[model samples]
Target chain A: MHCLNVELGERSYPIIIGSQLLGDAQHLLPYIRGKQVCVVTNETVAPLYLSRVLEALSEFDKVDTIELPDGEAFKTLDTVNRIFDLLLERRHNRSTTLIALGGGVVGDMTGFAAACYQRGVDFVQIPTTLLAQVDSSVGGKTGVNHPLGKNMIGAFYQPRVVIADMDTLATLPEREFSAGIAEVIKYGLICDEPFFCWLEDNISRLMARDPQALAYAVDRSCRDKAAVVAEDERESGRRAILNFGHTFGHAIEAVQGYGNWLHGEAVAAGMVMAAELSHLRGSIEAGLVERVRALLEAARLPTAAPQGMTTEAFLDAMAVDKKVMDGRLRLVLLRALGDAQIIDDTPRELIEQALQTCGAT
Target chain B: MHCLNVELGERSYPIIIGSQLLGDAQHLLPYIRGKQVCVVTNETVAPLYLSRVLEALSEFDKVDTIELPDGEAFKTLDTVNRIFDLLLERRHNRSTTLIALGGGVVGDMTGFAAACYQRGVDFVQIPTTLLAQVDSSVGGKTGVNHPLGKNMIGAFYQPRVVIADMDTLATLPEREFSAGIAEVIKYGLICDEPFFCWLEDNISRLMARDPQALAYAVDRSCRDKAAVVAEDERESGRRAILNFGHTFGHAIEAVQGYGNWLHGEAVAAGMVMAAELSHLRGSIEAGLVERVRALLEAARLPTAAPQGMTTEAFLDAMAVDKKVMDGRLRLVLLRALGDAQIIDDTPRELIEQALQTCGAT
Candidate 1:
């Protein structure tokens, strides 16, 4: 078991990463402020782990469950309203605690619901997927995607605690596991060269779902993400770095239609486009771009934006991304491997060049 | 002009209560951080003042207006989403500032939109109605209502500045002007005997729309609310006192359907019921109950819950109120005419009697 603190002062919470931790209720009790507990999960995860979580929470005075339809397509305000309906129907109050017990989509929706329910309520995250455990669940960035844009509406609501049970990942699909690696690789390129190199060396073991390697990767990614989030909880300045390829990545997800490419796959490809832009700008060596592509390709993730998405479409979608500062197309580009910075001065033609090169014929 | 601070530490904001201050864009310039501005207002308020506000914001690099349908019925998540759609469509970013230019419904939806847009953005409240200028616009409470409950979804996001222009209240309907007084009178009932006496002495003048009397009432009410909010921003303790009559009041609003009875009208009746409950508990003299009824009646506000609402219905609705603690229906009851305390041990029979007597057949 590994416990990492996000260090956000009064809002600081622990991220617990371990195998076979689903049944560990003792560690979760402190975060549950009220007797009433509502666990929100997706259909896919509920069948696999609902009973185990319910059994773990059996000691609570009251426990309930609401299972949402699985997948990124369901991550919308309407779905969030369903969670609110169940909570209100059950007469849940500010004191009630909501448990988000699925991957990123469930976690984001539940956290947002908790943030808005009765103004705000206590909620804990039980991330079941590698993508969530390493990336989304740690930071207090909880929101739902809009039809027009990915994660267009959300709140920076921190959870009371995050319990990432690695055992749940054993049931995750192979493609989803690879998508999670896209975010895992992000930490390496953005700030951690050593971890990036380690990922390159251990890509096959991670691909094989080696438990020890997964644990190490999850722990490292969380530490790095948590550090960035702690420094800038609201993404005012330093936190924008965390969305390294997300400007392009979110555009990809929105353009290709959410749930088609998967968040990690889109980010995997988005990272390549950003790295290529950096190389073109003379900030990084071409070898670094190849390495990033090589790593994503090894994980079976997309290395380029989807076909039929023109440069104009990418530009249009990217303009709506949250990272577009002061109406300018600001993006996170690598100064070098393991180093990223937000740049808004990139020429429009260069952006078009990168978009055209990355898009399919 | 009366300048009052809500005293929420760094989140504390100023409430500027004055006559004809809406056109003075200098006072609004500092709160607006971004070059882009989106002013959210309701249909009722737009034709009357939107042009003036637009004129005030003419200096911004870009300014947009979204006028929503008016009334409490429109205060839903769906209506709030319309604001989000406009923001996303317009490419409003994190630095963008949103200004809410209307009564409670518009203020609330706009505030919630600002709270969720790019996680959050700065917003200024240009409260038009008497109800909003005195009550909802002061503290940083922002949210939309759900089908099950009033303000079931919301956030405690403070505004950058609140511009409560008395000039706007001139166009308010007589009922809304009286409704705003309900919250103003509450200040005296909960904590200030002098203010209660002042309201009694000046109710007619306030009803007549005497600018000075309105100014004094709005200033005093804001001062009382700001002090309480500063002490307990999240309502864990002292802040709950502000909802003294709201426990009964919100139930009335929900049962009768939102907008049927203005928020303050329901609260007026609920305050009377609460006073009756206090009388039954021997927490206060019988004269206090009569005084509350008399004040509400003098303001021409309802002193009884709407017809057809049974005790069971009220209990069920109140049970879902945000104030319900540990599954118990905790209530804010008067210890004296000018003092209130939260009591959970009030007998069920007394509560039933209060509801039965105050609710019409």
Candidate 2:
């Protein structure tokens, strides 16, 4: 296993990546300080891997579990309220660490619950899916979806520890895998051309869940994410690159009622749109956009926008996006496939063209 | 005017205490970065002081307001949700500083909103009530009440500045003024014997709204709280002393429903209970307890327990209090009027007796 530590003083925590780490979590229990603990997960993941986690935490009988409905739609303020209620009902204190046991949605909601439960409790992430292990579960970006936006209400709290159990990905559905690779691919396109090339070479092995390729992918991705987050935990500046496709992706998800597209699937489509915008704005070559599109198609992720959405509605939704600085929509466009920068000055014509290419009105 | 700083790097801000600080907020706006400002208050405080605050910020056209229902019961997760909703609806960004314009409840809820809005935004406190100015609005104790407990959901997020308008307290109802004095007295009881002596001599003057006495009280209390919070922002150690009466006070608030007694009123009565326990444990002299009780009575604050509350209910409710350490009650007891210590090893019979003295049975 490879380790990357997010240096946040006493609150700092580690992200570990390896094939058999799930079996080694017993060694990681020192981080969870208290008599009681609660592992929060979702229906999809609970059925496949909760027993394994419970078994991992066999030392603590006070261990309990809560199963939320799976998907991005369940990442609502109401869902977060439910988690708070559950923790309160069980009387979980600040030391009672909440273990998140699913993908990004589960990690976000549980981390948020931990952030607010009894003012704030410790939490650990046990990301079961590829998208989560490499990304969401590592950084402490915990929150529920807002009525008007995604990830709007949250805290920049760090987790106790992040335990990515690679074996759990064997049960993730094919479509989920494709969606997961979008984020895996994002790391390459943003800052690491070598990792991008490595991913290109090993995409099939990663898709097949080959232990070595999967471990390497998770480790390298988490290292990159941890380094970026260590420098800018609250998204003051450098953190914006992680949202390279999120500005457009969030609008897509918002317009489509959020859960209609997998977060990664929408992001895949969003990245294509963002890259095309970068091309039109002269930051990235048109061929780079084609390469991004080709990679998404190869991974079987969506590259086009959702059907029947209007540019005006998309723009309206994007304007309310948390990424919009001072009311102007700021897009994180690729300067090239291996580089990205935020663009607040995108012309109306280019945006309209990108929307037209994506089949939006 | 008296000034205190939170000392939390960029999150650090000042607390200004004086008789007429409401109208003085305009001078503090140079620290405010953007044109948009959102003032969040309740109906009662709005009519009393919002106009004065608005008059100070007349230079900003984008001033918006979110008026929540007034009272401690309204300090719920639902009310916090409403604030986030309003911020999103209004498209308030990080540059938008939330001005909390009421007592502890509004300051806490607003500060909590600032902590979670867009992962964190700047907020200023224009605490209108004595309880807010001298207590909750100073330290970064911002959070909403959970049905399970008071402040069971919150963060230790500091404000950009705390503007305590003592003149606003002139219109405060007598009961609320007495309630607010509980926390003012707490600062003396927990950390400063000299201040305790000072307050003992001037309690009558403060009760009469003597401006100089009020100014000294507010300033000293903010100084005490700022020093503790600077040393321990998250209640890790020194900060826990600030919750001298809060464990019992929280039990009272939760059992009676949040607004049944003003938070400080419950805390006032609770301070007496803690003093009684301290006497029983030989940590403090009974004479000091009498003085604490005498001062509370002189302030016209409740010094004894309420009628008809049973010991079992209080005990059960307190088990859920945020101060429960390792499944046992961790009580903050006074060594004297000003020197306090957290005792986790107190005997059950002693606590039961203190409960009996407070009419909890």
Candidate 3:
């Protein structure tokens, strides 16, 4: 078991990563602020792990559950409203803690639910997939996708505690596993060159589901993410670097529709475009961009935007991204491998050229 | 103009109280985060003050407006969703600022919209009605009402600045004027015995809309509410005391259905019931309870609960209140004319008797 703390002063919380921790009351108990709690999960995960969580929290005075449909398409205000309805119907109050018991979509919606529920409530993240365990579950960015943009509506609400149970990842689909690897690669591409090399050497071991390798990668990703979050919880400054590929990735998700491409896959392609832009700006060597593409390909992730996507569409979608400031597009571009910077002064033609190279007609 | 600061570190903002400040561009310019700004108002207020606010912000790069139906009945998630849709459709990014130009309903919904739009955005409060000027616009309590409870969905998002124009209050209806006085009197009943006495002596002057009396009341009310909010931003401790009559009042609004009785009217009756409970609990003298009722009646506010409201319905509604902790109802009850405390252990029969005395059938 590995426990890492996201040092945020009074708002700080611990992330516990281990096998078979889902049914362990010791870890989940301390975070429960009151006797009343509700576990929010998706239909896909509820039948698999809901009872385990319910049994773990059986000693609580009152326990309820809300099961939402599985998929990014279901992440909406309407879904969040349903969670609010369940909590209100059960007479849950500010003291009642909410446990998010699934992947990123479930965690995002539940954390958002907790953030807006009676102003805010304590919520525990029990992420059940590789994609969530290594990324979204670590940062406090909880929100839903809008018809116009992905994650266009949300909050920066931290969780009381995050329990990343490795056992649950054993059931993740093959494509989902690869998607999680994209984010794992991102932490390296953004800040840790050595970790990137480590991934390069051990990609197959990770693909084979080597427990030690997966644990190390998840821990490293969280530590990298935690450090960034601690400095800028609200993404007002340095935190923007963590979104190295999200700008283009979100556009793909928004243009192609949210559920069409998994978030990590979209991010994988986004990182390639960012790498291309970095090369065009003379910020990185062309060989590094090739290595970035090779890595995503090795991980079975998309290395380009969907073929039909146009540079104009990408530009339009990117304009509405959360990163835009005062009508200027602020992007996280690599200054060098293992180093990222938020740059808004890059020429528009350079970005357009990068998009063209990445199959954005 | 009298300027009072709500001392919330970094998020601290000034409450500017005076007459005829609506079209003052100088006051509104500094708070605009970006060139893009959206003004959210209501039908009733839009026809009255929208043009003035728009004229004030005409220099912004892009300006848009959303006019919701006037009244507390429209303070729902649906209305907030409409605001979100407009912002998204217009490509309003995080840099865009939102200006709420109306009474409490518009301000509360607009503030909530700002809090949830792209996670959060900047918003300024241009409160037109006395009720909003004194209460909702100051504390950053932004949210929409739910079927189960009032303010069941929202956030504690502070605004950039609050522009409370006394001129708008001149156009306020007599019923709305009376409703505003209920909150003004709350400041006195909760923590200011002297203010309570002053209100008693000057009730008729305020009722007649004397500018000096109105300004003093608005400034004092904001100061009192601001101090409490600064001490406890999320209503954890001292802030709950600020909700002196709100537990019962919110139940009144929820049971009678929100727009049926103005928030201040329900709060007026709720204050009367709280006084009755305080008397039965031996915390205050019967004479004090009579004074509370007498003062509300002087303001043309209802001093009794609605005709058909039952103690059971209030209990049912109050159970879902944000103030409830772990299924226990924690209510802010008056200890004396100038003192209030959040007490959860008060006898249920005493509360039921208090409800009965307040016209609960």
lDDT, candidate 2, B1-361, per-residue tens:
7777768776788777766667765556876777778999999988887888888888885899989898887888889999988888988876688888888888899999999988888888888888888887666888887667777788878877777767888899999989888998998999998998998999889999998889888888888888888887778777889998888887787788777788889999899999999999988888888999999999888876778888787789888788887687888998766788888888888988998987787
Instruction: Candidate 1: give the clashing pairs.
Output: none
Q: At residue A109, what lDDT does model 1 achieve?
A: 95
Clashes of 3: 0
Per-residue lDDT of B47-133 in model 1, one digit per residue for the tens?
A: 999998888888998799999998999999999999999988887888899999999989999999999977888899999988888
TM-score of 3: 0.99
Q: After superposition, how far is residue A85 of candidate 2 from its true place, in Å?
A: 1.9
Off by over 4 Å in 1: A359-361, B359-361
What is the Cα-based lDDT of residue A3 in candidate 1?
A: 92
In model 2, the Cα lDDT at residue B268 comes to 91
Docking class of 3: high
Better lDDT candidate (1, 3): 3
Candidate 2 local lDDT, residue B76: 85
Give the number of the best model, judged by DockQ.
Answer: 1
- Candidate 3 local lDDT, residue A280: 99
Report the Cα RMSD per candidate. 1.4, 1.6, 1.1
Candidate 1: global Cα-lDDT?
0.88
Q: Which stretches of model 3 miss by more than 4 angstroms?
A: none
TM-score of predicted model 1? 0.98
